[model samples]
Target: MQQSSGWRGSADIWLQAAYENLIESGVDAVRIQPLAKQLKLSRTSFYWFFKDREELLSALLAQWREKNTGNLVKQAERYGESIIESVLNVFDCWLDQDLFDTHFEFAVRSWALQSNDVKAQISEADEIRLAALRSMFLRFGFEGEAADVRARTVYLTQIGYISMKSREDLAIRMKRIPEYVRIFTGKSPEQRDLLRFYARHNYTQEPYEK
Candidate 1:
C-alpha cells in the first residue's frame, strides 16, 4: 500500500512534528503512527528518516541542547558595558521565543523526571546554564558567594517561571523586568535601558505599579 511516487515527509518535518507533539502531549504520545496521521503521510516515512523511536527521541534531546544551551551561552557572551546592560541582554532571551524555548525547556524537564539519563542531562544542563549566568555576575564586579547568589536569583527565577508554567502577559512581564534586574544585579536598570526594552517590544500596556 506504500506509494512509491508521492512526496514523502523529510527528516526535518518528522522531527519538527515530533517536537511539537512532545511539547503538547509529552514524550510518550510522540508515536510514529500518530505523527504520520498528523502529517498526513504513511507511517513508513518515519522509518526512512529516523532509525527508530529511540533515535528520534535522541534527536529531540540533541535539538534541545543545541538550541537552549547554545543560546544561553551566546547570551552570556554578548558584550555589556555594565551589569544592567548585560542583564537586559539576558532578558531578551525570555522575551524572544526564538531565543528561548521555554515550552521546550518545560517538556525536557518533564521528560527528565521520568528518565534517569534525561535527568542527568538536565542536571548537567542546569550546571552549564547556571555557570554561564554566574560568570556574567562575576564579570560585573560581583565576586565570591555574592556572585553565585545573584546568578542563582536570576537563573532560578526563570526556572521558577517554567516550573510554575507561568502565563503572565508580555507587558506585565516587561514591567517587572526592572525589578528583576535590580534584584539580580543590586543596581537599578537605567531609564534609557528600560526605554529601549519597551521600544524593542513596542508595548502599549505598562507593567503594573508596585
Candidate 2:
C-alpha cells in the first residue's frame, strides 16, 4: 500500500484543472470526467476534492476573486515616485498574465450573463476595482470629479478591451501607450518614463508612430 499520497494529490489540482478548463472552454466544460481525463486521473478523484459541480463553480469564482480582483486592488495601491510611475505600475496588470488573468476575468464576466450569483460577484468586483483606481487618482492630486472620471476612463477602457475581444498587436498597443497614459492621467508622461516602459516591455527600439 502507498505510505501516503498527502496533499500533493489534493484539491488544488482539481481547482487548477477546473480553472484551465474554464479559460479554454467556458464554464460548462469544467466537468469532473473531462478534467479527470485531462489529468489522467479517475472521475472518482474529482469528488475527493469537490463535492459537486456547484462546489467546483464556487471554487472557480473564488479563484477569480483572489487573482483578478486581488491583482487590480494591489496594482491600484502600488506606490511610485510620480503619478506616471504609478500609472505605469498599474499598466503592468495588462502586460503580465500572472499578475492579472485577462482570460479568467473575461470568462467570469461572460458567465455572469447567465448566473445572477456570478453577476453580483462580478459587479462587486467592478465596484471595488474602480474604487481603487479612483483612490489612486485622488492620491495623485486630482480632485474628486476629475479623479472619478479618470478612474472610469481607465477601468472602462480595459473593460472595452475585454468586451470587444481586442487582439491588437503588442507593437500597436505599445505605440499608443503615451496617448493612453495622457488621457487617463490628464498629463503627458515623461520621456524617461516612456523609455522605461518600452524597455520593460522589451520594445527598446523606436516604436512605429500610429
Candidate 3:
C-alpha cells in the first residue's frame, strides 16, 4: 500500500493505536480500519508498516515481551546492598508503569484465553519471569525451594493485583511496602532502604504508619 499524499502512519503510531484498542476493549477491536479512522489516516497506510493485522498483533506481543518481561528481569538483576533492597528494586515495577505495564499485561493475558499460540507465549513469559525472580533469590543465598516459593509469592501477588484490577491509594501502598518486603524476603528493609525506595517514587512525605 502506498502512502496517502506522502503522509504515512509510522509503525509505532499504528502499533500504539492497536495497543490502546486491545487494552481498552480487547484484541478483536484492533482492526486496521478502526485504527485508520482513529488516526485519521488511510487504511492502506497500515500496510506501509505491517503486512497484515497478524503482523501488527505480533508486534504488539513483541513490544509487551520487551517492555514488561524484559524490564522485570532487569529489575530483578539490579544491584542492591541486600536482599531486601534487591526485592525493593524489583518493586519499582509495581510502582512505575514504565517498568511494567500491568494493564497491557492483563490485556495480553485475556487475549491468551482464546488463542493457543498466545497462551503458549504467555506461559513461556511466565516461566522466564519466574526464573529471573528465582535467580535473584538464589544470589542472596536462598535455598532452591525457598527461592522458588518466594519468587512465586512476589510475582503472583503482583499478577493478582493486575488480574483483579485492584486499586489502592499510592500512599497507603507505600506504607505497606516495608512489611511486604519483609514478608517476601524474610528480612525487614532498613530505614535507609525504605527512604531510598520512597525517594525513587517521589513519595516525599513519611511513608509509614505512626
Q: Write the per-residue lDDT of candidate 1 for residues 1-210, one digit (tens) a residue.
A: 122334577888888999999999999988899999999998887787788899899999999999888898789878988988888888888877788899999999999888999999999998998899889888988887998888788888899999999899876788788888888888888777777767777776643343
lDDT of 2 by residue, 1-22 (tens): 1122453356877788888888
* lDDT (Cα) of model 2: 0.84
Residue-pair clashes per prediction, in order, are: 0, 0, 0
Who wins the TM-score comparison? 3
Number of the top lDDT candidate: 3
The lDDT of each candidate is 0.85, 0.84, 0.92
Per residue, candidate 3 scores C-alpha lDDT tens digits across 1-210 of: 223335676888888899999999999999999899999999987888889999899999999999999999999999987898899999999999999999999999999998999999999999999999999999999999999999999999999999999998988899889889889998867788888899999998775542
Q: Report residue 144 deviation for candidate 3 (angstroms).
A: 0.4
State the displacement of the C-alpha of residue 178, model 2, in Å, after optimal TM-score superposition: 0.3
